[model samples]
Target: MKAQSTAHRVSRTLLFHVFTAACGLLMVYPILWLAGSSLKGPSEIWRKVYSLFPEHPTLENYINGWKGFGGVSFTVYYRNSLVYTVLATAFTIVSSAVVAFGFARIRFKGKNFLFACMLVTMMIPPQILIIPQYIVFSKLGWVNTYLPLIVPRLFGQAFFIFMFVQFMRGIPLELDEAAQIDGCSRGRIFWSVHLPLMKPALFTGSIFSFYWTWNDFFAPLIYLNNPKRYTLSVALRSFSDPSGLTDWGAIFAMSFLSLIPVIVLFIAFQRFLVQGIATTGLKG
Candidate 1:
């Protein structure tokens, strides 16, 4: 009976692993395909559409893609992307944390009403705000500049605010009290006491902000017209021309390269992401 039970448990575990492996492969196949296609010769890209790996595996695509169009190379676009991504991400997370800390810990008049208003902003579609925002930026002479992309994030993002507030509430109030007894002000308590403990949520928010800002195409497209100022997302779109030929291999190569930062970030900080979501909004 013991022998039979051991055999059954081993078989069940093996079956489970096989099922999960299959699901993981299905999800990862597109990325695998993109990597494979990026190595193929331009002609071979379309000729062998279903091939998993390139026959020749030439680096020609990477070479051409790096050269970019105009006088500007892809490195310039990468720099632009990095600037926008890093600045916007920092602003978003910091602002969200500060705003969330206030909403969670501070009690003042009209707080509930203000919280409700912030919640309502999240439900409004971003497309609705685009025209009005564009006009305002244009009037300020901020169009075709990085200011439009970077400045708006100085204000806290609604989604991150809510997430941080929920995460903050889960922290013990005892810490705040202890810090107060030690002659720490609210700012000091937040900085020295709570900030370190809020690592999981902060890391999670930073990762999210990085991903969203790095991949954002719509805002960059609307605000930026200069080729030199274009981000990777916007610059990649320029590779296609309806009136002429498009370089599929270069597109694939750059596209895959652009995904690298996001992938690396997730792999590095995914533990925090999981922990942040898991522990948020529950009292000890």
Candidate 2:
């Protein structure tokens, strides 16, 4: 019986490995292909279309892509993206946490109703409001500025608020009560107890915000007019040739570079992100 059980386990393991390998290849093949294409020379790119590997690999594409021709450099666009992403993420974490705490812990009139309204807001498609938001920003003369990108974050985003509230609800109310019994105020309880316990949720929220703002194209294209103010997403559009030829190699290289920040962020906060989501929504 034991021998038969061991054989069954081995068969399952082998099957799992095969399934995992197939999935990994499906996901990684495109990235590998893009990287392979980026190393190929112009002649190799055109002539060796059927080949999976490049005939001649060179760094010339990366050099030209980084320095650019005229106007703004890739470095400048990267800096712009970094700045917007960091600021927006920071504001989102802080504002969303505060609002979530109010909804979860503090008792105010119509609190449940208001929280329900906030949740409903998250269900609404953002595409529906783009026209109204654009008109509002234009009316305020903020169309050509970063204000449109950064200002809304300070008002507490709906999705982040919901995430925070859900996480906060899982924390024991006894902790807040205990703090109150010790002469601590509501603000102190939140700052000292809830906030520290919510590191994972905060990290997750911030990472999501960073990715969203960094990859955003439409907002930046509509609000930013100057070449210097362009993010990496917008700057990539300029890589197209005058005669309609696209520099696929340069685009892939720049895209690979753009992914570095997000990769670093994930590596740094991965532990916190996992812990936060796991602990959150455990019990009221």
Candidate 3:
């Protein structure tokens, strides 16, 4: 009876692992298909739509995709994307941290009210604000420039601020008092005491900011007009002609390349991302 029970438990564990592996493959199959299709010849891509392995794999798609349109290589678009994504992410981290610090640690008249108002902003859809934002940027002569993309991030993003605020509140108030006793000013306490402990949250926010800014197509589409100023997302779209002559192989090749940064960023900061989400408002 003991041997029979032990065998039964082993069988169940093996079944569970097999089921999990099957589910994981199901989710990852599309990405595998995309990678395979990117290497496929143009004709084979459509002809063998469901094929995971290409009959004729070639480097031509990547070579042609890198050549880009109108004598401009994809190098320029990649540079534009990096510049905007990095600067916007940096500004978002700094501004959101500052705003969150205020809301989390400071005590003053109307503080709660102000924080509540900021929370309300998060409820509003970004799509609704696009037209108004475009109008304002147009009036300011900021169209066709990175300013429209980078500048708004400096003002503070509500979602990041809220996340930071929650994380900050989880920290012990005793740290602030200890810093005060050591003759440290509020700013110094924030800089020296709180900031170090907030690294996980900051890293989490940075990952998100990087992904959103890097992948965002709609805002860049509205603000940027010159093909020279286009980011990777916009440039990728240009590869698809509305007249049904889309370069399927080139699109897939560029799409695969475009995913590299996001994938790298996630892998690098994955530890902090998990910790940040799990520990928010739970520490102390």
Each model's total of backbone clashes: 0, 0, 0
Give the higher-lDDT candidate: 2 or 3: 3
Among all windows of 10 consecutive residues in model 3, the one with the lowest summed lDDT is 275-284
Residue-pair clash count for candidate 2 = 0
lDDT of each: 0.89, 0.82, 0.88
- Once fitted onto the true fold, the runs of candidate 1 whose alpha carbons sit more than 4 angstroms away are 1-12, 276-284
Residue-wise C-alpha lDDT for candidate 1, range 55-128, written one tens digit per residue: 99999999998988888899999999999999999999999999999999889899999999998998899899
Error of 3 at 101 (Å): 1.3
Model 2, 1-284: lDDT tens digits are 99999999999999999999999988867766666777788777778664558878987678767975366789888889989889988998899999999999988999989988997997798788888999999999998789999999898988889888888989999999999999998889999999999987787777778877888898898888887888888777766545656676777677777776776777887776566456543211
Model 3 lDDT on a 0 to 1 scale: 0.88
Give candidate 2 regions above 4 Å deviation: 1-12, 47-55, 241-245, 264-284
Q: List the candidate numbers ranked by TM-score, top first.
A: 3, 1, 2
Give the true-structure RMSD of model 3: 2.9
Worst 10 residues of 1 by lDDT: 275-284
lDDT-sorted candidate list, best first: 1, 3, 2
Whose TM-score is greatest here?
3
TM-scores of the models, in the given order?
Answer: 0.91, 0.87, 0.92
Q: Give the TM-score of candidate 3.
A: 0.92
